[model samples]
Target: MYDSGKIIAGLIVFVLLVTFPFISNMGKASAKPKPSIDTPVINEMAVKKCVEPKEFMRAEHMQLLNNWRDSVVRNGDRIYVNTAGQSYNMSLQNTCMNCHSNKKKFCDECHNYMAVNPYCWSCHIQPKEQPNEQPKENML
Candidate 1:
């Protein structure tokens, strides 16, 4: 009778273990809505293809800085419209602040969300600014 009870208890434990995953609602709150598989699909040729413009760099990404300067100072606008034919307008102010502000709040939130490892703080300084002293004075 003791052996039978042991076998019944073992069977109950095995059943609970196998069904635990299905019964658990641990992930239900955060689960993303499933996309409809029956939705009509459009062919690739039917959709307009937009290629991101090649990022310009003169020396070590200097061109990006120049572009930023031109967009901010010369154009007097933060938006850089790439008439070179693209679907989206690249905004310097929006993109920069989106990642740099509050370090952990906005930037880290999305970085952690997408599992991307950023290397900006390692080599370059944040809030890029002009040198306070003149180059000639530094040489003296």
Candidate 2:
């Protein structure tokens, strides 16, 4: 009990050091990370909609994609009928990646933010990047 005073001070210092980050960041305005979804392909689509609703797709896209993979690979079912009764080819490359061609912008955006390493790319080749085509001007 002779070193009780020193023990209490050391404990206080340890607690403050452990909670330093929380204390320092308290009440400070932090920038909200905005995941980019505005790719050229998506913007140019005639029907700006997915097989499912946007919120559903955002939250459960991995699960949906897994289901599609299993159906196509295991059951030989190549068609997906959404809740809206619309049928789509069960393909990650041709169907899902068709609209979301820019993996860096669309897929990577949320994945990187959430620190999720989806194994979809390990088996599937990423879609080729769409080249930016500039309009040609004719000289008289």
**Each prediction's Cα lDDT score?**
0.45, 0.80
Candidate 2: tens digits of C-alpha lDDT, residues 19-75: 999999999986544656576767898889999999999789889999988998999
Sliding window of 10 residues with minimal summed lDDT for model 1: 35-44
Native-to-model Cα distance after best TM-score fit, residue 16 in candidate 2, in Å: 5.9
User: lDDT value for candidate 1?
Assistant: 0.45
Model 1 per-residue lDDT tens digits across residues 15-50? 989989876955576543332212122123365222
Considering every candidate listed, which one attains the maximal TM-score? 2
Clashing pairs in 2: none
Give per-residue lDDT, candidate 2, residue 77: 98
